[model samples]
Target chain A: MELLKCETSDIENTEKYILKNGEKEIGYGYIKGVEINPIEIFIYENERSNGYGKLLFSKLLEIIKEKEAKLLTFDLPEEQYRMINIVAYSGGRYISIKNGVRRYILPIK
Target chain B: MNNTILKFLERHDFDLSLIKKKCDLGVKSSKDVNPIIAKYYIGKGEEQQRIYVADIVGYDYSYMNLDNSNIIDNMSYFYNENGDGYSTRSLSLLDIPTDEIVYRLMGSFTRDPMYLMEADKGKYVIDSNGLHRLHILKAHYLKELSELEEGDAIGHKILEDKYMVETMARKVDYLKTYSSFLFQQIARYYGCDFDIRPQYDDYGELTGKVTIELRGKNEKLVLNDKQFIKLLKDEIANFLNDNSISKKDKKHFIDFVGQTIEEYDSFKEYIKQNLQEIYNECFSDEVEVG
Candidate 1:
């Protein structure tokens, strides 16, 4: 996936990273804070499963690691099965389930 | 250490741990050494907290503790390994609903209104507890939004997806706003002092005299007037040579400055007085004026 970095000349607060495969925006993703958690992320609908989610997860993890937070917990909505699958496939462990959302915890080390 | 530094650290709740560390570093016995140690400890705490030292001024609140009812789960709360509250600013700017805010102070003391942000941490209160904090947030948000590519999405309140743009075109009136406060904070980070005051007129445009002071004695530290003037002229020349500034503004300022060059009294003073007006007209968030 190609990364669309924010151009300082035409600065944007939009998605920090716009994921694309060739000409199409296969998916777009950005970090959202739940608390100080960098575990919050969004991935758009797409069928291409070429490890982009893993790449995106790793990128987001790098940012969180730079923060004071050591480990990040992913609060994934149950409906987003692809994301859940990606997280699980990438060694994300089920931390807990609460309020209709499943939380996955990962140590960024 | 001066009382100011001691009080600053104490107010922020960093005294105990920081003092402990300073003691470990052989700081206690050293006379007049608290400020140095305090500065070191503050830097360490600032890094450990993952909060930007710059954003220290941008947020204000009182602490409710890790177990406080005010603490919400899954929301990003930042402390300076201490307090002064936390921010998850990417969500939105300050939305404090209550006027009274509760903050945590370590050590024995009754709570009263104090600095929105203490030097070493201490307090976790509402982001809206202080007016200065709110003002900082507003200016910050404006500056953030101003540079973003959201022109088509102007007035849209959505911050995440589209990243809201400047909606106030003609309604872009604000108080005698300027950048001195920000400058001072940045200067402090660099271990210096800066004072800035800029006046504005009834129309929300900058007016009257402006004062800027950067305190230092070293030769390199003192700002040279001629060099600064030359730099300003070059920057403005480059800016006007490029996109967006109205020709009318460029010429009006030029003509006004030129007319009284020989006598160089009233009109020159007027031009000098109105430099900020010209700048605000050219740069402040408003419809481009010719």
Candidate 2:
């Protein structure tokens, strides 16, 4: 897998990182705010179920650690069971489920 | 905290627990401090509870004037360990300066409403509710200023043309203050870069064609001024229509943008009536009438 870092030009403090496999973009995710607030990860419909989501997620976790962020948080739609599973497997703590979304947080270490 | 608001909260039997005494940067003037009172709906469906937060602004209603005189004067508030409202890390994350924020704050009135919350002895701070919007506005403001500066440095010959220079300088001066407000409403979702050049004919007279380069996530659009405005409006409308954004979020965005645009139009009208002479006075020495 190839890692491509996008620009941090946004004043909103949201940056995107892309994971590619031989020029075919597999997945992307956003790391938001200086606080390293809840992140959003997406695996293209055509690229799902192939473990790329997990691969992209692991890479993102490393980035959060490199940034020295205290925790990794996720606020995702409840229907995203696969993503919830990945977070659970990675030790994300259940925070709450509100307005059709599940919120979780994982300490950096 | 204002006495009237406090009495109202007391009369309503508002739980004191909802009010957090977190804004402690140490500025003791009451007028300088604007209290933040935010409402949150915790949980969902049957268990949902509505809570009004005083002093500490919640994330949803966190729109604050981060560069407000009260906040800037008490910058140390962001460095405190217990102050969860804002942190030094968050300020550094955006890497913006106090002066720049103050400049942006002048035009952020409608975009960021004042929230009143008294805590820690007449001390209060703005929260991050509309942080993303403020940052977007700041981004557009800074980006446009930088572009104008670039034109100043590169288009020397363009400025030498007295007639053309007069018009350009006036527009540049107008944009220095107001362009960001105008662009923020429509260009909020797009990444834009401008390339303004002094177009010249065979005889070397300036024709004044400025190029705007707009980059979206997957495409690059190059447009002149007229085309750029029309296309940008159309594209943003299409984005609002096609995207899966929640109705509440969409309405919030539209309402804020609509108000700011009105402010922008009124300011432009004011400048048209009052600032023309001032612009001429400021730029007269810089242009060569030959």
Candidate 3:
């Protein structure tokens, strides 16, 4: 699948998963609060394993820190153990469970 | 020609009356008589009056009279090169020849405070006298006046002014050095590599660009210009949620970001107007309709 980089506003129909090419969007990440380079990464099931999750998580971390983030945190679904593993491997620590979702943190220097 | 007789007359404090009487007897000049003429008497009595008469005659006979004295000597008694009056008592301190006494007196008189103040409001006091003292003090003690000449005084003034200019220039140089250090610290904090270039304008302003190079593939989020702008707007909105920033300050901050990215002013205004909406859409949970 061709990786299409578009603005958040350009992404149409949030609910409908539009499948095109061999690349399925594993997850979506968005910049969050302003404690410097903040980002929230969401992993989708289709792009799980195969190192895409790890690659995506690392990319998000690098981008956020370069954007001048002092801290980066994200929410991972409690059931997504693989995604949780990937987050943990990327220097993320379990912060707290909020509303049954596990929150993780990666402090950017 | 009887030196013994003249000496006997001087020892007894002979008046001009005695000198005139001795002169007819053919005893003319006396080194002894010269000393008596130079002697100062305090009270305005007959003895002092006699001394004055002898001085006038001695001056005339030796051609040291007011009109006939060397111009420098004539002027030296009334004024110095600095144009201050000379007291005979003051001249006794000099070790120079009798004729050169005028030169030494003028030098001392020129440095006198009364003359200096009347001449130029202490400009000479600071530039000439003060600098001389400062130089001597730097040398650990006062130097002899013989060692200091007119050329040295001018050089001292020039050196002082040069020192002042150098001190000021050094301070500016130090400030510029400190500013670059602070800039480096800030750039490192942002996780961006920056090369701080010298600022040319006044007020020591610095200008440079920050390069955010992604370290690994898929390891970071790279955004286009539009996405980056939108992300900035979201970040600003989040910051303002509980911040005490005024509306004007918020607008100014938006304008500042726009300027940083070289965007139009109108774009900043438009982004600021829609910041809240963008935040709500991006961050708020949506209700899924199947």
Candidate 4:
């Protein structure tokens, strides 16, 4: 699987990467900010339960580490149950819930 | 109906006639009836208490229980057992009490009603919608009550000043993107990094003071001139033509900013002299022709 970096213009310090398995785009993920990276990952419906989500997340972590960010954080809606497990698997800890949006933080060493 | 809920309705002086039983509404679904007066079942079987939602508008009448102490102080953004899932954007409106909502509430009745779910046996209610309107109303009531009770004109004046400060803070926040971009351009021209960090009070409210830092290329802090930068920002905001303020206030503001420009010019001269000294120390001998 190759994670191809995409050019971003509108938002500063935000990076997007598209995941490809033999030229077939399976999913994409992006991380924004430098000191604290607010990351997001997405896998197509047809690509579910095949570990592509984990792969995409791990690849994004590499980019975050390269940027020397202190931690990875994201606000997750309660309905996004599938991503919860993936975040939990990657040692992401629940921080707080505000207005039905749960914040999770994964410390980057 | 449970005895507790019945007494709650009585205490609040709700229009009990408008409340129809779930089945008595004569609708195929609960959605067909007016949601404000519709009966909802809280729990299952015997524990279930038939409940009615109340539409409390600040215009018509005020409920005693929904005053400063109960509804305003006890409003929670957290999720309760009732599962009223309000978005963060909707819930965040409770942060600042603005005059716009108050004017609307006093002018006419609006359909946007705050949905409060009875929690902990009707002690407090979790907030759902129309939080901003409810906050502004309750805060205004609280302010009036305080003025009456204490009879302190100075205290009332302080409240007025605080309100002005809060409004200015909000205006600054509204112009954050443009002001920050402008600051970035200035920073780039000066070969430094500019960052504006907002200051918050004990309650996490914006205090209208921001720390404007100028950092060197090595990320070391060079200057921390927040007051000067804040004045500059206000001057820039005024230049952008924010006519929401009164004409008298605008004239006073322009006069205030006119003095700041002289202060800024002197400040600029100081920086230029300092840079000239640094240039002499570093590159005086290195200059061969140019």
Candidate 5:
């Protein structure tokens, strides 16, 4: 239930979590520095298309705002259409697409 | 020209039976059959030449020559050729093997309008055989063959060599580690405890097989075939959903899943269908009770 920042020491733990929970690990976003933040919001295999992604993403937005980060970004290379729809519904801005990876950014007020 | 090669093949002490067997195993064309026969018939003298062509196409004995010399016209022929061909002449003036030359020829055939048409219509083995050649060529020849992008040529050469070793050689110990890794991943996903160690057979044949020993008490869930299928399907679905994989990868994954399901289902069905015969064959030592 704890929302903690992922550190260099947590690499193995994060990998294990990713493997265990599958796409649900997307909710655990990465914070790079004072200015940049990257968030991942996963749609679990069984729970896909059930509005859980949006709820988790909303929580991620709240976290980004709390962190006072300048730029917020996330990449959804797979399931682009579904991700795009979710991001658009959540009022996130579209960023550039490069190397088959789609990036979306939400500015913290 | 093909006839000439065929005649040469016949004249040599080539194992026609083996060649015929290879052809039957989807080798198909005369070009593929010839080199395999030639390798057995005339080893070392033509070894380098065979290696050169195999390095280009990414498979052994699955290609044939279209017999056109004009580079433009022959692009289709080269694209269509599925197996390896041997030529004493180095492909380039620098005396290097002609793997790159054939690779590019195969690549251009797929991209060019005329060649693509032929490939789409199945006029050639362009999809399975030519498509792979085209990929290797494009990867290596995005620029001129000389200005190859990183690992392009080397990658193609490796694929070619791997195929040759897989199909032609009596033993392929080199690929054991790679195959082991793949098998381990598959076994782990299936929730089966297995160990695969490499060892040679009595004839000194280098072979590798997984020794899957079921660990722990036989759980009821594992014993249920229907549950196993459901678990497999769920795991596959999760894997596909988790990875941001490409379209081509998805196709391959789906095909793999289908094949696995079919194999397991068929095996189970065979056991059920032949239960009485199998019981008689194995339990004949037991005292018969009328």
Candidate 6:
């Protein structure tokens, strides 16, 4: 698998990368919902739990750090099952969710 | 479910390799899970791990029982043995190793899909009604000591509790792809397929109820956040412009977001310094950004 991190100029609100296995596009995701790598990530369901999500998140962090981010944050939606557990278990605080979406912001300083 | 446990184990900083390595079991999940399972899988055979883990997991929900619960507990107020439900029968938690199911069960909360909701603090709703899922979920967990039987997919018996499956599907709103994803994930974990279709009686009479089958995973949803944001931004701008939200309300909304979000970012700081004033001066009546 290959990891490609786009530049900040290429960063949209929810920036992402194409996850490929050789010539095929297996999945696409990038860390978003925070200033740096805090919480948002996605790998196709068929490709989940295979260490891809974690690997992608880690790679995104490297790119962001190289771009001069001293800290990062994440705000995960509660219904995003895998991430909710991930953030909560990682000591992400539950600030609120009543405003429509739950928040678990992990500050990587 | 195994994946969730492995995730939980990793986050807790448990050493996954059990032998020669130190890994953050979740981030570095390649470690063999046998180390943790060994602590609970005290039995000798095929079902040993399954049954042993269930015992430990089942204990966490024990507090939901009246005998074990306090009078002030909200669970006590919601607990119902036989009442309005898909069925009073809850015979399995599938093969979910207990604790992980709790996390899965709580998935929709802390933010989740359409079927489950927190009606109030610590309360959950299905189809706008209360559901004591704890009783039902636990009622279905199988902790019996035995060997693996053929065709032994987990949640088979629970699926036999047709009312539960159908009821959940009935509440599902298909507009959100995540809802289907949730169904798929939950079912896949149980080694079952989940489906929703029109309900029919034994004689082929249309009951008008949505029927659900424990089967099949769907293709994953495409993530097009850039497109979604463009649409959402347009929608929000239109709403703000059409509604003529006053300068006061707009600033209040921005301030609310600022106060609520404690984490700081240079982007947010940039918005506050460069954009907030421009928005207040020019786009207060209409949200248009460059």
lDDT of 2 at B22: 21
* Model 5 Cα lDDT, one tens digit per residue, B247-273: 455455445533433443432233234
TM-score of each: 0.24, 0.27, 0.22, 0.28, 0.22, 0.28
What is the DockQ for all candidates, taken in turn?
0.01, 0.05, 0.00, 0.05, 0.02, 0.01
The residue-by-residue lDDT of candidate 3 on B1-290, one tens digit each, is 13432332244343434323322211112112221111110011000000110111111112212343221123233222232222222323323332232334344333431111001111111111111112111111111221334568874553343222100000012122222222233333345443322222122122221112333423334343344445444544454452444555444443444352243232233334544453233333751111
Off by over 4 Å in 4: A8-13, A34-37, B1-290
Tens digit per residue, CA lDDT, model 4, B1-290? 33433433344443433322110211111112211111111111011121211212221112112233233333332212232333122333333233343444432222433333222222112122334444334444343333333566776564444332101000112123223433543344335565544433333333454445655433422222354445555544443355554545444433433343244343233324432332232234542211
Question: Could you give the CAPRI-style class of model 3?
Answer: incorrect
Candidate 6 docks at the CAPRI level of: incorrect
Weakest lDDT window of 10 consecutive positions for candidate 1 chain B: B166-175
How much is the lDDT of residue A75 in candidate 2?
Answer: 67
User: lDDT tens string, model 2, A1-109?
Assistant: 8878887624366778888899899888877764323466788887764567777878877887788776666665645656765675465543333344555566676
* Order of models, best DockQ first: 2, 4, 5, 6, 1, 3
RMSD each, Å = 24.4, 22.4, 41.0, 20.5, 22.2, 25.1
lDDT of 6 by residue, B86-133 (tens): 232221323344335554554433242222221211122232112345
* Cα lDDT over the full model 1: 0.35
> Could you tell me which residue pairs clash in candidate 2?
B35-B115, B35-B116, B35-B117, B36-B116, B36-B117, B62-B128, B62-B129, B63-B129, B63-B130
The alpha-carbon deviation from the true structure for residue A94 of candidate 3, after best TM-score superposition, in angstroms, is 2.0
Model 1, B1-290: lDDT tens per residue? 33432432344333334333322211011012221111111110001121221222322122222222211111224312222223322222223211111111111012211122122222111211222232323233333333345463643343322221111011101111112222332344336664333322332233333334555643222223333334345544554464455566555544433442323242233335434444344334652423
TM-score of 3: 0.22
Off by over 4 Å in 6: A6-16, A31-39, A65-71, A88-91, B1-290
- Which candidate should be chosen as best, given lDDT against the real structure? 4
Share of native interface contacts recovered by each model: 0.00, 0.02, 0.00, 0.00, 0.00, 0.00
- lDDT for A84 in candidate 2 is 66
